[model samples]
Each structure stands twice: as structure tokens, then as C-alpha cells.
Target: MSNIELNDKKIQILEVAEKLFSEKGFDGTSIRDISKMAKINIAMVSYYFGSKERLLEALILYKTSDLKLQIESLLHENLEPLDKVNKLVEIYINRINCNRGIYRILHFELTSKKREENLAAFAELKKGNLKSLETIIREGQSKGIFRTDVVIPLITPTILGTFFHFHMNKPFFQELLHLNTETLYNDYIKNSLTKHIQQTIKALLVYEN
Candidate 1:
């Protein structure tokens, strides 16, 4: 179901679930915990989502639906391939910044025991996004703007891994860099980290032997 179609109560449950799941992990957080946190009955959550797994999937879909739409819009725009790629980096960084909890939930689930089952939907979403990036890269190659030998698979990892690595190491980096405030750390991600990722992707795509 679309994010718009979800009622207020369902959205509330999902939001609470996202936070709890991020903090306590998917298995650690229970339906009762979500109900208590959301100030709703456990029965209401099951009535809306049927199961914990389904609820998690719904939350993921809700978080990612907007990104998918934005990516589609960017793909249809009449911009240069490199420009589109840069815009994508900005969009991705913004999404991560705004929904750090959701990303944490995703990372936790992907490493947990039920990872394969829990992450199936997310894997599909990631696949589609990768395909979109591949399309852009291919388009650039056709235009002779991007290197013909550039590997899409390697490029995807370099971009996404960089973001993930920075996010996962926030505390360490903060201490190392003496980023005394959350505002400063977030600013670094939004400005410095984003520019670094964008430049890395562009350099990889356009580099010539």
C-alpha cells in the first residue's frame, strides 16, 4: 500500500516501530513494546499489520516510497547524466540524514538471523535503485561522457558503502575529528561527506586511462 493510503494510526505504529527497532533491533523489540510506546493496544497493531514481519516491511516501504518517486522524477528530467548522478547523491544523503533510524533498522535486520527473509523487500528496492543507476551510467557511456569500462557494480558499492561506513562510524569519527556537537557532525555529513561521495562517483564514472 502507498504511504498516503496508510491511516494515521498505522503511521503512528510504523513510526514507533521504526524507532524501537532501530534502538532495540527487530528481534529485541516486541509487539507489546511497540504498543506501549505508541500508546495503542497490541491488537490494533496486529489488526493493521497482521505480523511483526509485515509491520517491518510496511515501515520500510513507507520510508522508501518517497525516495523511489524522487528517483523516478530525477531520471525523467532533462539533465546531463553526471548532473543526475550528483542530484541522486544529494537525494540519497538527504534521505539518510532524515531517516537515520530507518537506516539503522535496515542495517540491523540485514545482519540478524532472519536477515534473508526480513530484507527480501529491501533487497528488491535496492536492486531497482541499482538498475536505475546503471541506466544512468550506460546513458553517460553512450554519450561518451562516462568511461566505457566503468563497472556499475563497483561504482554502486563505492558510493553506498562510503555513506554507510561514515554513518556506522559516527561516534568514532566524531571523537577523532573533535566534532563537539551533533549539529557539526550532521553538517559534515550533509556538506563534506556528500560532496566527497558525489566527487568519488563522478571521478569513477569519468576517469580515463
Candidate 2:
């Protein structure tokens, strides 16, 4: 086949595989299922991606970078620390609130054992984001704008983890907490989550710096 045709087919295969895997979980989806869903031969899946493991890697690579670029753009700006944090949270909620496919795929990939190269790539991405966050927290503390005791490493995960769990696990929370999918969770994401994170930081306030 032509190079363009080959590339398109590869993208098609990846897109289909990503959606199926996100919706069905890793074990629940198969190469044949991907092939059938893509309307291509099973051989094509193996040909383009080599193996199911590699396919999963490609999916992880695709999904993991969605928020990374956004974070990078925010960090490059001179916005205040508080605005930066809010923008990050807003982007986080906006992504999950709109394209749930990304949230689902990313959530699944977080549980998988990806290849070393993939892991390293993610570690670098994470390091950049963490550095941005740490920069903001440290700056805020220095400016007497935030509590000096607000630990980045400690609450960083809690803030992000809470955002991920609540935004990505909305369906389960609905089934578990009887949350109103249409209105209630949206409210919580905007008001409750944002406020909780802000208040958590407030606890470390030094008043006099």
C-alpha cells in the first residue's frame, strides 16, 4: 500500500484500539476486536504496531500527553500562582468533563505496566509538571501569598489524585454516591473540588509570613 494509506491505517487502528481499550479495559479488548472494529485485517494491527503490548504503549503515548502540553503552555506564562493553579484545575476538569475518552484511556494506562521508554517519557512529562507546580508553591510561599507549610510533594498527589478520581470516576461515584450525573458532579468539580483544594492550602497560612 501507499505510505499515506499505511499511515492513515495506522492512525485508524490506534484510534479504534484506544477507544475500545478505554471503554472495555485491557483484558476486555483484543487485537482481533481492534482489527474488526477498524475494518482492517488482523495482520495490519500486528504489522503497524508489532504486538498488542506495543499497541497499548502507543495508546498510552497518545493519551498521556493531552494535558502535558496544556500544562506547559500555562507554565510559560507569567500568571500568578493562584491563577496558574486554577487554570490547571480548569483544564483538568474541562478535559474530563468533555472528552471522557481521554480520561478513561489515561486512567487505564496508569494501571498498566508500560515499556521502559514509555515510562521514562512519562517520568519526564511528570517532572516538568511537578516542577511547574513546585515553582508556584515555592513562589507563593516566598511572596507571603500562601502558607509556608503547604508541602508540594505531600499534597501534590492529593490535589491531583482527588481531581483525577472525582473527574474520571464520575460514573462510579454516581452509582456509589447516587450523585446527579448531569448537575451535581459538575457543581462539585467547579465549586467543591476547587474550594477544597484552595482551603487545603489555606491551612498552611503563616499570616505574618
Q: Model 1 over residues 1-209: C-alpha lDDT tens digits?
A: 33436988988999999999888988899999999999999999888888888888889899997887788788889999999999989998899789988876776555566575655777888888888888888999999899988878787668667988887888899998888799999898889999999999888889565
Best-matching candidate per TM-score: 1
lDDT of each: 0.85, 0.68
Q: How much is 98 displaced in model 1, in angstroms?
A: 1.1
Model 2 TM-score relative to the real fold = 0.72
Let me know the TM-score candidate 1 reaches against the reference structure.
0.91
Model 2 stretches with alpha carbons more than 4 Å out: 1-8, 99-118, 164-184, 187-192, 201-209
Identify the leading candidate in terms of lDDT: 1
Least accurate 10 contiguous residues by lDDT in model 1 = 107-116
Candidate 2 colliding pairs, count: 0
Error of 2 at 146 (Å): 3.5
What is the clash count for each candidate, in the order shown?
A: 0, 0
lDDT at 200 for candidate 1?
92
